[model samples]
Target: MNTVVSYIKEWQQALQSEIQFLKKFGSNKFLVSNGRLLSTDGSYSYYFETTTSLRIPVGSSVRLEWGSMSQQGRVLSSEGKGVILALEQSFGDLISEATLFHDPWELLDHLIERLDEIKKDKQKRLRVKKLMDPSMPANHPLEKIKSNVHELVLRSKYNPVTFVWGPPGTGKTYTLARTAANKYFQEKRVLILSHSNQAVDVLLGELTDFIQKKDRFREGDVLRYGFGTGERTDNRQAITTTELLQNQDPSLAEEKEKLLEDRKLVKQDIARSFSKRDTNQLLELETKIARVLEKIRQKEIEFVKDAYIVGVTLAKAASDPAIYEKTFDVVIIDEASMAYVPQAAFAAALGKRVIICGDFKQLPPIAASRDSLVTKWLREDIFHRAGVVDWVNDGRLHPHLFLLEEQRRMHPDISAFTNQYIYHSLVGDHESVRKSRNKIVESAPFPNRASILVDTSFTGAYCLTERTSQSRINIWQVLLSFHLIHESYLSGLRSIGYVTPYRAQAQLMELILEDLYQEQRLNADIIAATVHRFQGSERDVMIFDTVEGAPQSRAGMLLTGKDSERLINVAITRTKGKFIHVSNQAFIRRHVFQGKTLRQLVEHQVKQLQTVETKDIGKWIKHQHLKLQWMHARKLENVFQDIETARASIVISLPAHTRLSPEWLEKLNNREKIVKLTVISESEWMELRPDHRVAEGLSFPFIIVDQQFLWLGLPLEGTKEIQPPFVAARLDSEKVSEYLLSQFITRE
Candidate 1:
């Protein structure tokens, strides 16, 4: 263990140095070494005898040697300097942290302690009574069911916050509707919201049905209603799952048609090449057509209109804050993780008591660095906040609750896969549910079950694809797929949803639904997507695409951040038996790691650790600075690695350094090929000429030019046109070495 720990620590130090180097250098080249040393910041002619010690320039001549760790060599020189910033080494620190997540039993113990306290508090508030009613109990029939619903509502009402950790197929939405109905019947005005439109529709339907069927509501009345369906006089259009399907523009249909036609043309071209017996032309044509077809297919996404407009309209709906402030007694928010801060703020304005439901293990919100409040707080400053600290320390906070050891959705096999890949600590073939009917699936085996296909393909590429901006990899695709699969697998029952965080993703889904209606004329399914789509919502089936990408492979791919998470919750909670993912591997890898390749770094470090000696611990583990502590380095590295390994194949983390000549740099900066120059004085301005330095191991190509050609040389005026060449040198020290080095080394 000490040996392992020591290796982790050493990797941590190396990683820190790498980060500092990157920050200082920005995009400059660096020197790297595994077991090699060179002249300190000077030209070194004494090259190593072995391949591992080869003093190659950073960006140039450093050939990548693939082999077992022991056989591989580290870099010695880059750009004539002895420092190639090792990003892969920097990423190794995170790997150590990931290995520590094998057990959360301590966390569970803390939760159980607080849960008792919560229960005791509830007991003190209630007056226990025995009900005796053969035909009708003294208490209402609704009260006879699960006390968990009322308990959840009560928790929210008193604390003004509560978390509902609804796993797949647990009837999360139905329970939410019942809870809201009870609150409403108790004269508490309740507002239900979800992040996805589909979840919202499910919640509205369940609540509306409860009001209409069970409560004996009369016809031609607004007593029974959901958010966007049927009729309402509250100036609110309850957008039914069906009504939402009609609001999209028909332009998407036309775009999709044109794309199909172009695809046909490409196929024909390929066929023609093959018919002519030209294998080379056929292959080239096939490649070109594939690229073209990808472009056409990405043109199908449409905006989810109603969902987006709701936020703006919500502002307009109730001009006086009091309308929302006092009208609702309790507000339930679903898919809280997907909700943006602004939307959450707006929802908070509605009432004092708000119930938020979501799982943090799934997708997190997609936000710019500046705007990502949740991620920023959770990652960096969470422990400083008292509320957050209480949750982490006590494991029982008012805002969140762990749904300990319960899972209802997924067949045994599919659920197991999801548990291994996505969710953790909850669900599965645990002892508690071994004999219970709550097994993953009734009869479907892992191998033969109707699989929730996890497709990781991009439909769009930047150079070739063009489509309606809103539909390009919208998160709603997961929600729609969830409904399609869940309804096919789970019961005919649809669920209820509550909006939380915000409604932005749901709005996007609406647009897609409209396009679907126009193109497929298939509107028989009972699914809904809404802002904050489905909080306090649950169903029988769920599908999610956490990876974002272009409409086709041509447009490229990326991850689905906040949007995917919200939709995933909606998809899982909406179904009782299934969960699926249609994703782009490249997209997820890019987004989850966010510029840092965590998985690769961790794996590399772990491998290194496996071979280290026990006594070298001080070299790796010891850190003088508080910020560079062993645990901190370990945790960050592990997170990076977890995401990296989870979706490894499709994503790549580029080398930290790239090499370029001064001429090439100028060209790149200027966005052109030719170098521009204006000369004046003979001494200051010189013509472009070859500067040949024949020093061993220090020669390369050089083009000596005047200061006038360099952008950093001097400033120009209207009358003077140019200044002196004090800033630029025709043959600098670095250039001279490069010219000489080229003479000694192989050009390639």
Candidate 2:
């Protein structure tokens, strides 16, 4: 590791080694250097000099990884075990501070001069070339998982394509960024794309943060480096947003024309079918056709905008005429599962290299497309049709890189639940990915509990009708609570969702949210009417108030199929914390089908116990305990089993247990639990518990009232004897005394 480094006294001399590495080995060499740095959990970077005294900008990322790398050399420096990162500064600002450092062309000129010195010394040039080559394992310190993928991408240079699929909190976005950054430093222009506006915004924020770092490129330098958007005004990318709307070029016009023609044909077919149908047939056709036509139109509009915006933006930047000019050396697309093949093709056509990233298990395109867009786009067009098969087979962009593993984001308990419920395959071998093993799982399991009280006969169809006073009171109570609770943020907050099964119920839910907001001060942003409107969407807190209007009939079970699944999913997932289900407890007891109860499915085990057979009985009990529906029961049993297994290593003593005495039972039955069956005179029966309050004792099963109803507590049914906990009452001030006296004192 001895070296005779020559000081040519120029910036070009400082970067001679890096420049030589790039010219001989191409962009892959630089990728190897940066890829290693990008893998770290924290940020780190270094500014290094070549063998010829040329200066090159090299940064090591320490923030992205969990640990640090041991000392290998000054080539890749470490702060203790941690990596080093180059702080990003804007070009305009950096240049304002130090003029010479901001000029890439000037730096380029100096570095070229320094290479001339290396060319003069044959042995020195050879030694530097060997170090600059990135083929050696020691050259890159990326995590083993990432390093393997990078190598695959390098080997498959001709036509590389990779798929990284995992559930939420898996650091999917971070992996995409790291791969893109690695390619970027190699002087390869890269593109980052996302199917969702929210996804795009999030990735944009992350990239902006990285670019704004002091050691990283300055904002101005990034713009110069093709990383910056056109311009910003009102906190938005002004040029890009404007151009996204008005890309009225011929290609765009052609796509629009095709869409309109397709719509016309679909409409014509629907009309023909309607004309030939009977009244009933025509009705069904009308509904189906309307839905299909609406979806088609939406898809078209989304496509036109998505395709036009990115293409026009890129074209405007590269005003040059070369069709195949390497505008971007590498491109990364997020939410690729939602990206159609045509959209991906359009992006691929513009970039020199491309990377598409998304989780297929989460969601695929719901647009009118007929295929798996990601698979078809990558394999057929990029590899087969384009004749980039060799590159793809070799793990190159002619191929692409696919990541299978995951990093961080979800707690083990939540992740396991999602995997079992949502994913098609199991998450295996990852020891860190397991059910929550903590002693304390939930601090607030039942943060908010609501009980619904229904009338005796349950025939109250007017319970949900807006015209009724009851409905108004219900709405008002919810409105008051919404105002009182400090809930929901407008932006940068977890979403807020509401869901109901019935169409009218859904409509009422919306009315409730809007009315409450109008009547009170609510700083909420987005609200959905039903589960369908909120599907594939998440919120921080959710409120579901079941509407009661249906009479007792089989048809009353309105939730079924996708609607049922959608409602359950929506209600369960809407809150990262507490989920509120506000409906009458009586309604739940009456309306919900009994057999459907999750707990009832567990059958009670009947097993025989005998002397000297205690061990076998215990084993059966243990298995039965494990099968119980309650989570707490399972936890307790597991703990007990663990203790028993540990205790098996040593002997323990037994203590005699005590039994209840006959005298104690006699005292409890005679005095503590005495029952008196007395027959009072017909009129006198009404007088019991004189201290308690009373109501009209309506024929209704339970007392029913609206927001205007207010009672202190349950009242006594009579003016004599023992008291009861609650009394049914309708709170109307004008009839309060009559209603109370009527229940306790019978009319003469």
Candidate 3:
């Protein structure tokens, strides 16, 4: 780690390790194409529709590029397949040409290449070591009450790196913004960074408003460096880096003009060359024009260095060239838990003093990588790499870590569970959490309790779960989310969030939600985002859909690791009023054996929760807890038992490889009344039961006895090719059964 080459090797490995492995963990990388103009606000923001809906995590920092013209925007929300982007600048000339989108991660290699040079600074290098392994003793939370520890940390000369474990709704952004504002007012250079552009905007919105009201931009520049649009704050004065260089800095503006002139000349030269039939010169001229544009970009970013207080995404800060030229008095990295370790290192290595603010218990970087090199350093959050999170997990305190105990967001009832397990008696509820006004139970969404777990087990579990390759879909969970969302909408809740672990599941649920919105069953404001994306945003009513009954012997990667704990904690803490996790208790107990987060939730919360069972589907469906028709059948005889009762029709879509006992089918055929039995399986199964057609691509199999609705099947020990005697559950609801049926069978 001493040599730059060695550090770069390890860093590069962390960055590239996922390339060689199948990504079974982390956030789904955002990549979608062919965006067209949808709508504009007549001023700044624009919405563009992509041809296909990607599981684009809303609020992600995205770049919309067309041919050569491009603009950066923060995704405000998604309008179906379209994304509502608050662009840094309006592209009025945007034509119907295909536009492409990419994430901020695309530009990070430049930052990585520059890190070695950054480490060349002796003071900064020493600071990074101190940050990585600081010997500073942790101060008591009472010490923060007694003294201005927040301010002290911001200005600390000795302890260069500080950790603030800011749990959900703990005013992490508020505290950081105020502290950053204080630094700016005190004439200390401060750069505040977060993992996402949305987070940056949120913090900057608070900081800008507070500072603007205090001094009204009288003394210094409180600049928003990387992003163009700040919808919440008045961005007219504190413009972005490009805007500042365009209007304020005379030298950079002049350079831009010269570059523009040079580009114009190059274009003219190309035109003249075309007229003269000088085809070979075209490439040279285009390259010259590109160089001029690059020079122009370099000139434009010059404004990035002069800001008194700059707020930007960590990726933006690291990759932004002007940031490399300047050093800050303090660098505060908010959302350190979600942030990659290198992101924290970028801050720790840049500033003389640093404040790493995040809750390690919350989700880490959603990396698809499981490599030890990447997991230990690159993808893991700074809190984990620092080993303080381990200390807390082991019932020990890390000296330099400051754990924020009091949360003002969740009601006392909801925060009670997290305080006991996740925080281990270290955290408490603020008085505001206990306020009668914050009584969510008194509200419409959950009339009984502040939180509840819709145990899918008691609600006639399905033989075949609404699950796909990545545990992406549990139709019951998806439908349950839709039902809850609809109920919340009817009850007059506008800000509702639905969090799931898989991006595919989120996108699928979004489709159902869109259908619900179309039918006027739900509002357009309801957003279905991944657990990773739901952080930093508060909702009035929230639903955490843990994709249940993972088909395999192992519950998917989403339910394992400390990252899973973080995901659960974040989803739990995001709700201000009411929260419900539509979960499969049976799966968590048996399959999630490696993880304790889900098991603990079921074990503890169920004791206090009103056990809403599925003995009757009609009643459960009304409340969004469905399933009664489909029954759990582990043995083929149990499946035969249900098939015998089917007087109308028997639709069988079992695993193609399943070797059904011939006697079972013979008995099924010899029923008192000859009923139509449709077997949708591989061609081989069709050969045995010629009454049915072939289910070409069916993976998980099931039988819907006397029902048109499909019941999914999962064996106790599931495999790609599930053998006999696998455990499968039943879903009885007719709603969306046709949908699940469509996936299994190809109708003639």
The number of the candidate with the highest TM-score is 3
Question: For model 2, how does the per-residue alpha-carbon lDDT over 255-361 read when each residue is reduced to its tens digit?
Answer: 44454455344333433442323323323433454454445445334432332112222222222122123345555566655553333443444454455555443
Q: Judged by lDDT against the true structure, how good is candidate 2?
A: 0.33
RMSD of each: 28.5, 29.3, 10.3
* Cα lDDT tens digits for candidate 1, 1-748: 2332332233233333333443333222222223221122232211212222223322222222223221112332221221222222222211111100011122222222322332343221121000000111122233433566766765555554455665555556777777776675565556666545455656655665776556543222212112243343353333332232223324444454455455445434433432333323423443454454344333211112112111112221222222332335566666655553333334443545656555554445442223233334322211122133245345453233524235654445334544533444345544433344244333321212323444323322211111223333232233323333333333332332212122333333343344332333242343445423343344433444332344333322222333443344344444444343344444444434533222222222233332122122233222222111112211223322322233111111111122333543233233212333221221221222212212221111112222111111111111111112111111112222232223233354
* C-alpha lDDT of all candidate models, in order: 0.34, 0.33, 0.64
Error of 2 at 733 (Å): 21
List the candidates' TM-scores in order: 0.35, 0.37, 0.70
Give the TM-score (vs. native) of candidate 2: 0.37
Look at candidate 3 and tell me the lDDT of residue 383: 81
Model 3 residue 31 CA deviation (Å) reads: 11
Model 1 TM = 0.35
Model 1, C-alpha of 537: deviation from truth (Å): 11
Q: Give the local distance difference test score of model 3.
A: 0.64
